[model samples]
Target: MPGDVGPLAVDIDGTLTDQNRALDARTLDVLRAWPAPVVVATGKAMPYPVALCEFLGIDSAVIAENGGVVVIEQADFLSVHGNPDAAAAVLADYREAGHDSGWGTVDLINRWRETERAVSRDQPLEPLEAIAADHGLVVVDTGFAYHVKSPDVSKGQGLETIATQMTFALGDTVAIGDSRNDVSMFEAVGTSIAVGNAPESVRAAADYVTEATYADGFLEAIEWVGTTD
Candidate 1:
């Protein structure tokens, strides 16, 4: 099963995109041409991945907000599995401490975030983690941001559900990512790839580590799974 491309669960921030978070035009072309199923999994807001799928011209299958929300395309399957209220508590305390989310007042990062809150990577993590723990929420450092979410929900769980619904075995899938937030996803798939820019811990967790960084690494991963290099 590992010999085939099979299904793909890919990350956005530092895997499909460059360090500046721009989606790689080169990777976009490759992704659309993949013969197997593709799942856009990200720590981003729900609308972001959904919109990406729309632009990619693929069906809407996504695991957004670090698995806080799962949408199975045209099947009308929408499952939200996090405590936004708890996440809000952490943010509220963060504000009380005279700290902003650091994305400016508009806070587009968390504005459309329904199931959780995303704190800018520049913000101090200790206080936020304390607040989240007080509210029974967990904080995940995705390298791009700190996500406050429920412990029960994860990208791994989301992939498992989507795999079942799509009628594919987990052993037939591949996952590519570049952050600790992707660790769960790495564990869930049969073949896991860590981009060159990924943290050492993330790379250690993956089944293979790419020589190239960012979207290039994504393309390298696809090639390893029997897709065109």
Candidate 2:
């Protein structure tokens, strides 16, 4: 609502980072200059996206842990979804099977997580799905890692909440991501973009797929929003 483009929801990792998960200087500058409200939507823990926004000098708007946690510029406006206990039970069953969750013994990745847990992509999806099902949890593959969460939680839900709070319709929001987990958001937003590096499924879910990859693709997506009706 701050500008003509309305609010923007963007994923981190493969969408905002390079192949090495590094943010380019150009990407940073473009984001800082984005005309409207920008939300850092990622499958990372709360601290990661919150810190990213803080450093970017934008409103500390974030939808972290997929849709597990959400906030738009103020501590009082924070909203959280899902149940960590359910995800924990799933993780326990997974560990009992002798497979590591991918973060090793001291998992800094999940240390700050409140609503759900993230599993390493190195694990087989079938086995993980089985464990998650027993605990009524769903595993969302973000192309970077597998997220163990409640089926009820998703980025789409987060977008709805943030859009309402920001006084914008879902049709006024543009989402940019690069993974299967972003599909829910794609389905809910006015315009959805997938980076060129995304898989066929992800690309198919998007309204537009940038020819470029990574941060460059993110910049392309920003332009895409401007030109889009």
The clash count of every prediction, one per candidate, is 0, 0
Query: Residue pairs in steric clash, candidate 2?
Result: none
Instruction: Name the lDDT of candidate 1.
Output: 0.88
Estimate every model's Cα lDDT from 0 to 1. Answer: 0.88, 0.86
Task: Give all TM-scores, in the order shown.
Answer: 0.95, 0.94
Pairing residues by index, what is the TM-score of model 2?
Answer: 0.94
